[model samples]
Target: METFLKLFENPSVLKFTKLGLWILLIVLIIGFLRKLLKKRIEDTSVRYKAQKGVEIIGYFLIILMIFMAITLDDIKDYTIIIGLFTAGITFTLQELILSIAGSFYIFFVRVYKPGDRIEINNIKGDVIDIDSIYTTLMEMGEWVSSDNYSGRIVKISNAFVFKGPIKNYSMDFPFVWDELNILVTYDSDITLAKDLILAEANELLSEYSQKSKTKWQEMVERYYIENATIEPTIAVNLTDNWIALNLRYITDYKLRRDTRNKLFSNIEKTIRSTKGKVTLASTTLQLLKIPELEVQLKNKL
Candidate 1:
């Protein structure tokens, strides 16, 4: 232990030892603070911000300690050299710098945060985490349909925000307008079909209709947009084979698939209970013209 102490007594060795000790102290302090943060902060978003702020402060302190360990004369002599080295590093790591800048832009602009369902550059997901370089996502809507998670975690570079438009599903308005079409034979009761479909929609989507109006009013006030109907509506169109009743309604962004399933099931049951008054339409081919067929058989000898 005496030999080790003697080795650290050298001026250069002593300076580095102090720097290392300070860095270790910072790490321990940061760890303790993080534990306290976890215990004290219950709100997830607030906790995340505080934890990240502490981490950045810890890094800054470590860098400050390293700079202080260097002699003043060395800094004076190598100032220009350090400037040139930094310039080179900046050029080499320009993409990383842009990514950090993009992260700052995201935070400042409130582009999207953790828990926002967003789509950008053809990738769609619910954001799980956002860091300086990347936005982590619980990926959705690739092979799976209707906003279902694909069981993949995607890490997209934050710099991609600068590249394209982003669609946010759960931001100001957490509800979306979805349309479901029901086709009935031309001879079926179009009025009853529309009434049944509209009734089912009203039943399934009443909550969204009531809640989304206030949220949409906020959006209209914030953006340049006109008032949109939130209540369930039915529009009928006549086609060659069938009469189509398009049922449009508002629903929570995440509940679209389940809501649709329930609405369709209810509508089908209602329509079937009508007992052929509302017959669902299917494409049928009619044999308008048939080619002449000739058959010749030889008599058995």
Candidate 2:
């Protein structure tokens, strides 16, 4: 029993003992903070500012602990030993280091912060929080129709920002251009139909186009972005079944579902009011009598 106690008293062992104790203390403190963290963050929307506080505090604690361990004369040699370990850590855990770098990029670059909806790769969601190892997302737009949530939580490595295209839906010039295709009968009066559809789209899209244009111009002045033409219009494609009118126009990104519904409803109404100038296209069935039908009639006679 005395030998075991003496072994633990060794300086090298003591350094490890202190590190474990400090890490354990950090875990407990973090656990307690986690309980109150959600409620506190909900009251304020400055997630970036709040997370900056967390990052600073967490790193401070880690550094202090490391400093204390290094102060031990018995363990000063181990500090040199740790340098050798760093190269191995850098190689083996390179992905994790990149994730940490990504976290810093997210903070300093002011990219998509918590609560903003973003798409990294094909996964789309509202970002719930940014943790040390992974970013949390309220997973959406998979298995569910439209852009609705699947009621699942996803944690993606932050390094994905560099690996794939980062789509920030709520960033500067947050509106998106959604297209709906409507087909009217080919024989329909193309001019009148175009006018009615154009009228509906202009009324529906003009407001958002103006808003997006103003916002985009502000961004252009702040950054070197190419000038954009802020107009909402429809393009027509003539096809066998109908004249395909693609309503390509700007709309609030999050309100895509609602915008689509309004566009479709008004289109239906416009078609009705057009005095038979337009009709929704559909295939008609035509049947001809078979050779057997005439022979059967003659036989009956």
* Model 2 alpha-carbon miss at residue 125, Å: 1.8
Off by over 4 Å in 2: 4-27, 30-52, 63-80, 91-94, 293-301
The 10-residue segment with the lowest total lDDT in model 1: 69-78
Candidate 2 lDDT, 1-301, residue by residue in tens: 9998998988678777879888788767765665557567765555446655666577568767877776755555566777778788889999998887788778678788887889987899989888666889998887898778899999999888778788898887788878888888887887887778777878888888889989988988999889876666678898776789887778888889898999889988989887787888877778987775444435554
Clashing pairs for model 1 are none
In model 2, which range of ten residues has the least summed lDDT? 292-301
In candidate 2, position 227 carries an lDDT of 82
Best by TM-score: 2
lDDT for model 2 comes to 0.80
Error of 1 at 229 (Å): 1.0
Residue 29 alpha-carbon offset, candidate 2, angstroms: 3.9
